[model samples]
Target: MEVEIISEESIKPSSPTPHHLRTYNLSLLDYLVGYPYVPIVFYYPNHNDNDNNIFQALQRSLVLKKSLSETLTQFYPLAGTLKGDSIECNDVGANYVLVLVHGRLDGFLHKPDLGLINRFLPLEPSFDQSSVGSRVTNVKVNIFKCGGIAVGLCVSHKILDGAALYTFLKGWANMASKSEEVTYPKIISPLVFPAESLRLRDIFQVSYQTVLKEAALKVAASRNGVQQPTRVEVVSALLWKCTIAASKEAYGIQKTTWLNHSLNLRKKLPTKTSKDLIGNMMRVSSAVCKDNDETTLHSLVNKVHDSIVKVNDEFVNEAQGDEWYVAMHKLLQQMGEIGSVGPTEYYIFTSWCKMGFNDIDFGWGKPSWVSGLIGKGFKGFFNLVTLMDTKCGEGVEAWVTLDEEELKILQCNPELLAYASVDPSPLSNDHVI
Candidate 1:
């Protein structure tokens, strides 16, 4: 598909407030302090039919101008914190939000001209040398010539988790759609009711070490930093193909097993109000190897599903009430004396659709296509799945990055190659931006 590059500019930065952001009240404060950076992009597709114009869509989406910013300002301390020595909002002035506009011809091709998307993917936030909350950059809008638009937002994870972000986005969309008045999100502060506890040892008989090892092994076997695996390479060749094979063997073609991955804890929570939940409250549930002759997809998925259920049971048994919370505090105190720590590895699968970016309608309309840029630190042992809308065409568009050897394996996989060929869409060309 032919592509075009649009101009890049920074959005006006929000100012920061004085005072060190308090983490004591928020449960998810650790996330803020540890991995404060979050990149969010909104995709808007062109409206060939007479849907609402992009601006009208935004107007209908109430979260656009009021509730979102207000929510961010109200609960998320990171939103009000300064970047460097200055007292400006930590948001990097870069139009962290992107808008892409693509034409119907380009959209019909299905595959995104990589050249067009690449141009705007590598935006870095400009930090002030001297500021505290001053390092502010929030939303950015980028428009593509193909009539696709993307709103790129960079937020500090310290403040809001994926669930919180999604909730805010949904609220924004609902408001923008003018479908309802702003409803408050339910806030469940993990800090108020933390998850870990000492009684867990008594409640669940399973060994924590064993479970951690299993999860780590699965991730290690699937991904090694030496070689990365793009979502397409892994899903098409390993995940989906395995599912198909497993389904065929188990219950014939009539029965199929699908993978249902969960978003982070923040998104799944009830939203009457916002809370300061923190830590690795994220959970991911998926079917294991299905296509392999050794195991069926149903069995694999069932095993994982059962394991998750068991873990939840343990969580419920150990971390339920004020007594459990007290036990958890004691456990933390004891562990602190011995210098103990939490698990380092966990898995979660999420799609861009949850971020509300996929449906962002700017003045021009929706984006013909969209994608997440793979940044640094994502290599080796990390399994992050991103989703994008299929440009108007025969098949969908997916972008992934894997290690060299994995790439070779995927290229040689007949099942995967066959699947790729099934889609008549054109392959991506090398155009950045």
Candidate 2:
């Protein structure tokens, strides 16, 4: 698990950003994101024959840097620094580091240590100004002893969410592979959502990891006389239920809990093509379980489903207008009122399940595995769950962050264990690339 720094340099855009696009303003949605940085790693196994592997790895590394330079021209804002409320697209360049890992990639993935994943990235995913600073994007290319490579990317959450992040990755991969189907970023998110000044609160804690198999997803989605719940809904409901139960057990009494599921606002927008727009275009579908509420899995599923359904096209239209300001004010007001009503827990659930992270191939082949942060090696985050698609693309891997005591009780929950495997190896699936 020892990683050595092989090289470090900044990758500037091959072409200068147009003067008109120099200052990219932050959208209101971007300002609401709790974390300042988003980090992920893509593990690509060696595919070349033994003799050719070393040469191919070196050549591919050059291609990656070259293509990334070209890609940054289109994603110009990413190469800039975030200052105050806007990105100063002065072509300061992205932080790119090359590292050499001592062990084989396979051995590391066999029993992947969530705590050590941060080593792959240039910076930790936290809100600390000193650690994150003004850097808008950071990339680390990790070369393993077995010739496999792991590309770790850390982008400012102020600029992109899961959808936008995948868009950028796919575009970069397309350029690296010399594909004709080049993906271009549409940086119109700020024009659509506009920017506003606001302050947000922060929370801190540790994490736990679990993977919910597709079989469990099917069972959780089962219900009579109702439309099937999505894997996201079912998993979120189950985790919310289990965490609430854990909290009640750890403490002495039931406490009101709130679950917030983040929804991508691309498809709901007036322009369906906004799906390709790069920025934090998202909203939250919130549901609450009162102290005396029914905490059944089925009941929780319905609640989650209903809350999600409410954020449909019609709501999106209103959210795009004046209702947006009114809603923001109401949310701020509600946050203040909650403190006076005794103890309550809040959990934020975000899905990267169908974002196509596994398909980001850069000439060699698709990645064998992709990973998000498991909330280790940093602080200022808690009661958060990030659900990602498994390598096989059938199951959901939930990276949960909670307080120590609550997470301890949740680890031994029989119902949760029946439906999910805790921190399983990435190579457990036969279909991995």
TM-score of each: 0.52, 0.94
Writing each residue's lDDT as its tens digit, candidate 1 over 73-190 gives: 4333434444321123433233333343445434634654433443343343222211344333355554444333455665544345555655555554554455544545544455
lDDT of 2 by residue, 1-433 (tens): 7888878999999999989989999887887787877788999878554866545666778899999999999999999988877888989888999887888787788888888887887777777742324879899999887788899999998899999999999999999999999797899888887765554534423367788865555565565413678888888888999998999999978888888888998988877578789999888887888888988888888889888998888756555577877876776577557635877888888999889998999988899888888675477778889999997887888888888888889999998887888888888864222
Q: Which ranges of candidate 1 are over 4 A from the true structure?
A: 1-36, 48-78, 82-109, 114-118, 121-137, 145-148, 174-179, 186-263, 266-280, 284-299, 313-370, 375-383, 387-400, 417-433
lDDT (0 to 1) per candidate: 0.38, 0.82
Q: How does model 1 fare in lDDT?
A: 0.38
Q: Candidate 2 has what TM-score?
A: 0.94
In candidate 2, stretches whose alpha carbon ends up further than 4 angstroms from where it belongs are 49-55, 130-133, 197-206, 224-226, 335-339, 430-433
TM-score of 1: 0.52
